[model samples]
Target chain A: MPLALYTVILTQIHSSNKVVQIFGTINMSVYSSQRIALIGLGTIGISMAALHLSRESNIVDVFDTRPDFEQYIHKTLPIYMSELPSPNTDPRSSPESQPSTSLVASLVSSGRLRIHSTLESACASATIVQEQGPENVDWKQTTWTRIEAVAPSSAHFWTSTSGIAASIQQAKMQDKSRLLVVHPFNPPNIMPLLEIVPAPETSAERVEFAREYFSLPGSRHRPVVIRKEIPGFVGNRLAFALLREACYLVQEDVVDAKDLDTILMASLGPRWAGNGVFESYQYGGGEGGISSFLNKLGGTMQTIWDGQGRINVEGDERTEWKEKVIAQVNEAYGTVSAEQIQIKEARLKDIIGIQMKDYNRHGPEV
Target chain B: MPLALYTVILTQIHSSNKVVQIFGTINMSVYSSQRIALIGLGTIGISMAALHLSRESNIVDVFDTRPDFEQYIHKTLPIYMSELPSPNTDPRSSPESQPSTSLVASLVSSGRLRIHSTLESACASATIVQEQGPENVDWKQTTWTRIEAVAPSSAHFWTSTSGIAASIQQAKMQDKSRLLVVHPFNPPNIMPLLEIVPAPETSAERVEFAREYFSLPGSRHRPVVIRKEIPGFVGNRLAFALLREACYLVQEDVVDAKDLDTILMASLGPRWAGNGVFESYQYGGGEGGISSFLNKLGGTMQTIWDGQGRINVEGDERTEWKEKVIAQVNEAYGTVSAEQIQIKEARLKDIIGIQMKDYNRHGPEV
Candidate 1:
């Protein structure tokens, strides 16, 4: 289906406000309704469930092969929502904003979000199905084969695997153009980065649709499209590059892990928060701009690049480096507790929330 | 001299409030006085001068070989100060704060900050001198040779060369232990990262002094000591690593320069601003922390690392890549103007100022 036609159908459904029946048992008003199927119940799946439930308007269908799936959702959904920053608690949020608690409650009470025992029922009428079963290619392929049999022909698919290629996962699907990779940073509900990587078989309209849907106003997510289907995409590529150098510094005895973290937290972290590498370099040029910066400091940058470490974390040194790094990390941050993780997440939310507010006010033109 | 004795002498001078003669002519009351000399009046030099003059207490002496040094300072200092967020204008600043205008004027009227005709006059009774001459080894060596003969024996020095090794630059000096590399991120006053890298010959006491002095209360500079000397130190190394990948993406047609900047500004930039890489990964591990993070994702990280690009900007591809990047950057940013540069610097100051305020309120226990 053409995106324009699909959008038109959605608009018509929203405006009609007519009642619709699914499985001849559930009745829902067709007012901006979307049937979103979540095809796993792991950590990432639970976070996605909370995100969808918190919106209160989506019909979220969840499925997992485990027998304890229902119990897991019952036990974990409340905890996930509690960890999320409420508008009332967030300093950046206004008083009149909808609190996450009420939204999740509404979704549950209205039966708009529910768990299903079978994949056939979960994906029966899904307009958008998000698959996050496991990282292994075979497991994903098996799950998708089941999903492809029951999901609506026009339903768009989102694969949440971090490093798996979209092409390999969708190889057996009949409608290959509908499947694309929509990997998120961990704790997807909290962290806003959504890397969209579409395979060559995926349609351009679907990629555009994914980008727009994820970055819609009040979604609280930032979407960036990856032009090529490389492993790890952009975020991890950039992140691991930094981690590689950080490990090198520690291994080389230039600084301990604690001091390295201190250096980054105090310096690069804040600077990067405001400006990325290229922009920072442009500013560093001091009125001369990036051209002058390249002219003067390009040699220095190249020298540093040549000196950067090439340590392999999966190689022979993995055990030693891992032991050293873990020891130092544990020393710096005491035993990891649930409360400590909550505190860290809260701090991250505060930092990112304030930055988003500032970006809305004085961000670069894009 | 021992730090304890140095502190005692400074305390005595402050308590006595006796008149002291500098250069055998100028008489001033010594009350917590620090005579700081600034060499070279280029872009970095001017920012450093504004920072010192804004402090309202430091006696700053400046020198540049160029005959237009005075004119340049006169023309540039006000613009820099005006670009700085004023206490009256910044919502985060207190009402009773001294405005930057008065601070700059007071330094000039009281003869606390003066332009010197020669290096001899500039180094004459200096307690701390910041040298920001061109980033050339031979020029820096010659400049230091001239400065060593006239500077006070106990005076400390800050060599602000970004990539040059401090040992090579200070080889001609008799007291190599007093000089250390103190590289600051561009627009030194605005960006708070002060990388204190000490050479092998540098004294431990001097390194400690440098760390404490730059990070003094109200100094608005965050200092991180480098335990060992390395080219580009930490900030630039990490920065170039990110930039190298960014350029690679553009070169490989994964994304354009504009899209790459957009991706970073939206995702990695904000995340890094709040938490550095290791902490982010730790947080990403959910309940298991860094151990779980590495256990599950270490292989994926290694895969990405192996696939990373190895473009050399100083080698055969330098000209071609440089031309391509400059074109794209120019297309994205338009012609970089002075106004645009000032706007970026001001925005950076705003971001850092607010973050510092937050740190003062609810910072980590470090």
Candidate 2:
């Protein structure tokens, strides 16, 4: 069964302005009504649907192979379709199972989202085909191949894969330049930053269109170009770098985990809300600013920036730390049951949702 | 003429709860109205007075060698008394030019903030003495000797010194236990975190009192203790460590300064509001958490923990960098005159002030 374009939701349709439209390379214009077909209903895929559906009325169609997906969809989304793999299908025992791609079809039948069988049916008259397949290169290549074979040449192909270059995967398709990457933050529904990395083969017109489409009202989206394909792109590379040092600091016992948190929360974190790291340093060194800061403290910092301390990843050293952390948490605010924690998490999610609403309403002031 | 506390201010008596009394060691209580004498009005002294008067009703009698402080105080604070150093105050001249060591009679001048000529007059009858003297040990020793002789034993001594140990300075005072370091962050009027480091010889009771004094209501203060003195304390050490890497990264051209800032702003800065580096990793790695993060990425991090790149503080390197950084700023944000930049900066300051007021009024929920 082919997914219908009427299933599309105008997530951010500005009636006065009409729906936000993006002109794709193949003369396809993506509006609010364009049906979006998603393959692989994993963590990333599920989060994308949650974000998309939370907006105006963007209908998301999903497919997966899991038999118990109906239960999961009930937990993850309000409305979804459900389909089970045929009883005759056995990924291990039957060659038919390989062709069926049961996982792909299961994504739709989960009752929380829509799903379709063939790529032609999934992307029939669709404006966009978002491939949320596995991170592995060969797997993505195969997925793109299938998408290209089934979908019309006019459909814009987007991948939610991180760190993988669009060109590498695009080469598997006939119209390679039509593909681009929209790597979003983990739990994309909650975080708004989306790294839009386009292939060298991708055109400026197509890239601009994707940027505009992602920036629809009510969507907390920020896009930065990869410029060139680099491992980890921009955000992750910097994040991983910071995380790496944080780990070494903990492992070395330079400061306890709790106090280290206090150091940041009480000092740097609040300042960071208004200014980023470089800008904070810009103000921190006073009139002399960043230059003075570098001159006065650079030597001291070099001394402290010793080789990475050995990490205590194994349970032995960390077990004590783990218990201590749990104990400290319990001490500060009594130990919460799993259910209570979940309830609190949900409330936090609500607060975050409200914040996004306020942000959308106000927009970025500067 | 010892500076008189009761002589200053409108003295609008409010309810007991509105008084904001901070209980000190033993049965002594320090009210927000306690006259705080600020000695040595240098950069640190000026900043401290601004912060103290920003919210508190502390009568600040400030003394400085420079006579032209009235213009600055008039602009920043509604309350303050300024005193000029004796005329012909030159070391090269006769010793008679310098004010006598008995500072009480010479310095104190009756005003909203009683200007004091000597340390004795400045500390006389004051509940707290905030010393912003030179960082030189000899200068501090001489100043403390005079302060101890004149200040009542009941008064608590607080030093706004950096890097120097509280214990080392306390050894010169009669009331050693009452002396503690209240090292505030740069631009103390803006940044709220205060390092509440006590000397080894200082009593625990004094530590508790100091903490309470800074954390009073209407006071946007965060007090952190260092059980033992470490050069630069916790915040600076941690801050400098991060800064060194940023500089090194810029020098190596791994990333531009602007891009580095953008990466931090988009990727990890927001997350930092809720969780610091350690807590962020603890949560970032998922259930396995910090341990898992270390296990997976620790090796990769170790590979990149290289030494700081070349930095030239004087002459060619600095001059070149200054021009380059300024040009980069202009290129990024467009050409603007210094006056225009200053206007932009002032606007940012106003925004920060409003945000801070809102945060203090409503607490961190905003």
Candidate 3:
């Protein structure tokens, strides 16, 4: 047989799962040779591209609708790359002092990252297609449909929409099993969380493959599987719940936004950083554990929950409240300058680096 | 006037708040000279004593119902003191390697910390009476009454109860204005949170004094004023809200307790460690700020809020669930040994130490 014929036959076999194992574990080593198609040139898209490019040796083909999207990437990619920790550079060096010249140059020089002007070109041979378009139903639906039409039948689709459900986004697709929500927190390149929310039709084999692929040691990403699809998933749901109560406190004049932030930074922040809610309570129970803690404070917990404020953030008064809160926050934080924000992010990265180091030493525990 | 007559006149004038304030600002420098009476030598009491002794030169006279409480302090005080960041000791020293002999010796030899056999002796001249008795309302009430009987008229009372409201706890006191709940997280000596939930009768002057006293530069405690007497205050309310959702997720089997903890350690934990929920969303809004964030995701937030599971930790099913969670937690954390718990605390202290350094340099920003 001709070389092209052999390649086509093998691709068909792989896509049909005739060659891919069904009951046994899939070899994660296949990711090294896989091509990733990144659709959209927004902040998240660029961040995902930069992270994948710098952290892994996989070939990344990026697609965007804008004519000058390549120029935009060239301009913004450096900033995302700068956020990454370089092995050769001193980790403690001032962020401003150390330029990301070598890091960006290395990523470019590797010749593994490419920009495709058309979506069809980007998805032609990709094994993984990560869609990060605007979070609109129509835009996401159209984008996924186009990608699905051109991408290989075996390609796994990861939608990076923060709020949209994977099932809804992939409703029009022919094979829904390959599509899922792979939401990343802000600054996707740095923050380790990658919430993998699989659709109902998403195969267990594919979910396991993604879990292993994203959490592979070299990927530097922590992939959390969300078995059931729910609004905001886990991280944001928990965060917004905390945020709602915080807003209620401010509304009640219990504590100003600044003082409330200080309280969290000093106590709950550090506590949560080491141990999550249940484990913290478990520890809070002392030797008796979570049972003792819940038994002792269950009444107080119930009282607080019952009295928790139900402020309507989407109501007509939201604008007035936002204005008041913004003024108060500005009074406390001064103007939120880009420089100040960058400095804050740097500090956060440093703290997370310390935590990651500790986790590496002592495996993940409360 | 005679020396005795002159002293009596000075005391009366000082109690009247005439001589106490030399100028507009009350002399906070006097806190160094003011003695502290720590009533009840339980775990919290000992932890509070050790922190006060190690962090300040204030004389701490502790009293407990147990006859061998003195020996208990002699043995356990060292461990708590060792957890403190010693200015004289190396920061990188292992927890097991560094002994707190010199630290304890200095506190003892300075004539600053002493064990009192009787409550009256401990409270006779104390300017601050920190009551850390058992959580029982009767025990707290009787303890406070006894301390109030002997403590000086100008002394401030701090109740270290986690669940009981300051108002209910102080209802029987002669002067409620001076009593407030000074709740602290576990390992009080290391964790910096001091949730000051004031009673309705607590004077503004007293509140300001308590705030400054706990958060003063050298005190090494971050005090947040809970302006209203709400159940669980701020920390525990927010904590339990998050805990409820976490438990719900565990119950639903979306993720196991261990995986759920991993998700937090990676995402919400670190994010909140640097920025509280409100500020994080503010940042999440990108340059548009929090208004933008809420406007974009308000609907989704509402959905999450509505769908959030209302878990009843006090219900009968709690026991069964607690057993399952405890088993899972133990499998991950190895039965919660005291030594392991201390190590966890030490790690938290180290993380907080790094954060404190950053905050001191950058100052607190929302």
Candidate 4:
């Protein structure tokens, strides 16, 4: 039988949990491969693609308007799309700055990639298409609609958006049931949480499939149902509530920003990373515990609880804080740039992750 | 000068700095040879006295109305009061059944200890006194009045009460300046933070002295000022806010108690232990930092903010929650032993303290 015929037969058997072939090259009858496509080759997009390629899978295909296809494709994968490399700094094409093509070219030379010319050609046989384009709703809807017209009907479409509801994007897809949201935290490869929120019409089978596909052995993935689309979603909504108060305290001058962080650092924050909020109160509060504590003082807290503030994406207060922080930074350690701080923070995060892993394996006593 | 005259001159200089002089075989500073008078040897009182005697360069004088203190007191710091330890375990002294005393004795055998009798005799030129007695306001007032009559005016007084104003205790002291509320967050010696709140009339000089005294190099002593005497104090006030919601959620069946703890453990809690509610928000709310985040979401949070159900302390809600918690404990952990849990918690607290010290030095990144 032809390899294509054998592959088709194997895919059908695998879907039903049965083995159809047991030859050398096709040792596992269920080892069927699916073509995966990329929507935009921006920073987030490229990173997502790189991570997938880095998995060393024979299943990935790269598609971008950028003619620089060979730059990012893993030699084990293939890239196909309309010609002309995306302008390195185009906000609509790449969300983050494009890395030098040398990095992408190195992956391609590893000997397992193909570059293609058109969007239709890239999506013809693809089973999964991840859209990591500009965040603008209109732009996303338009781009997704065009991709939907070309991609295979069976392909699952996933959006990597932080705030937008998956259903809204899914509505633009021809096969809405296959559309879902896979909101990975920044630097997804490092942060273990991937929030899998499905739209109202999304199927359970697809959601389950997505969960299995995204979660590795050590990843901490959370499947929180939106039930209904809300402004910030669950994590952000709760997180923002805490953030609002933190910001209000700084703005009100109740506590210094660093001191506030220190207070959390000393007591609450690290604990939260280990135990959730309620358990913490259980351990921290005396006598009747958390419930009793609330009865005693919740009224006062309610009266004092300030609502969320407006988003100043421009970060006016942050700039002021930065100026003050710079002075302290200079006094403490001469001077340091934001880039240096980010680098230091990144390194610190890596150390923390290693420590956490060790802690889990050895128990906290060690 | 004559020997008596020289003694008076030497004592004056020592007392002026608030440090007592131990002129036995060796002339050691009061701190190095600490004389701690623990008044009212109730559960909390005896534990603290035993802790001080067992752990450091300290002497303990435990005073209580009970009539049989010999069995509990270490021979080194034998109890001697007009009234001895109560034969029947009073609710106030119920904690005596625990291993805390043995733990104290073990720590004491390592070489740091002493004990005494009589308020006046116990406090004779002593550096510190820990008052752990009845919680009644009038009872405390009368007890404190007696304490003022005998305690050295310069000695610092640390009262151990779950929830009471330091000012009230100070009002009965001869020298209000030396009175402070050293309220511990359960299992005092183990928990690193000792809420050091001073009374309204507490002098700045005395506050400074007390801060330094508690600072004790390796110890993590947090000095917080209560601008006004509010119920539950600062930590509890904040803790209550979270607990109220926990109860609300449980009561409303929005989530189970265990599930709630799990959610917090997985995300918010760990960060909170290190950063605190305010700092977590500052970092989590985006680059606009805290203030901007607050300005953006405070209004919305306020809208959704349901403080707590209006349950009177005597209401059925409290009893219901208690029952539910008890039933859940039996179901989940097999047996429900509050005493055992407390001991486990105390052990955990010590571990938290050690980890916290390491955390402060290296920060959450570690």
Residue-wise C-alpha lDDT for candidate 1, range A66-90, written one tens digit per residue: 9887666777776666555555465
Classified by CAPRI criteria, candidate 2 counts as incorrect
Candidate 4 local lDDT, B1-366, one digit each (tens): 233443466569666875334444322222355667777765457555644554345655555555565455643233212112223333223434433345436544654443344566666656677787877678777767777777767566778765667788666666776676766554343344455666777765555555555555444445444334445544444444454445445555444566555445444544444334543344444555544544665445544433333322343444355446434423433432465444444333433433433322233533
Relative to the unseen true structure, what is the C-alpha lDDT of residue A28 in candidate 2, on a scale of 0 to 100?
Answer: 39
For every prediction, compared with the true complex, DockQ reads 0.45, 0.15, 0.48, 0.16
| Residue B287, model 2: Cα distance from true site in angstroms | 4.5
Q: Between candidates 2 and 3, name the one with more favorable DockQ.
A: 3
For model 1, the DockQ equals 0.45
DockQ ranking from best candidate downward: 3, 1, 4, 2
How big is the positional error of residue A258 in model 4, measured in Å on the Cα after superposition?
3.3
The per-model lDDT (C-alpha) reads: 0.73, 0.56, 0.75, 0.51
Give, for candidate 4 chain B, the lowest lDDT window spanning 10 residues.
Answer: B76-85
Candidate ordering by TM-score (highest first): 3, 1, 2, 4
**CA shift at B314, candidate 1, in angstroms?**
1.8
Q: Give the best candidate by DockQ.
A: 3
Residues A18-109 of candidate 2: C-alpha lDDT, one tens digit per residue = 64443222233334445577776676777666555554345566666667765565555532111111233322233232233343244345
Task: Find the candidate with the highest lDDT and give its number.
Answer: 3
Going through the candidates in order, what fraction of the true interface contacts does each contain?
0.51, 0.22, 0.56, 0.22
Predicted candidate 3 versus true structure: per-residue lDDT over A168-235, tens digit per residue? 99878888888888898876766888999998998876776677677655666889999888888888
- Compared with the real two-chain complex, what DockQ does model 4 have? 0.16
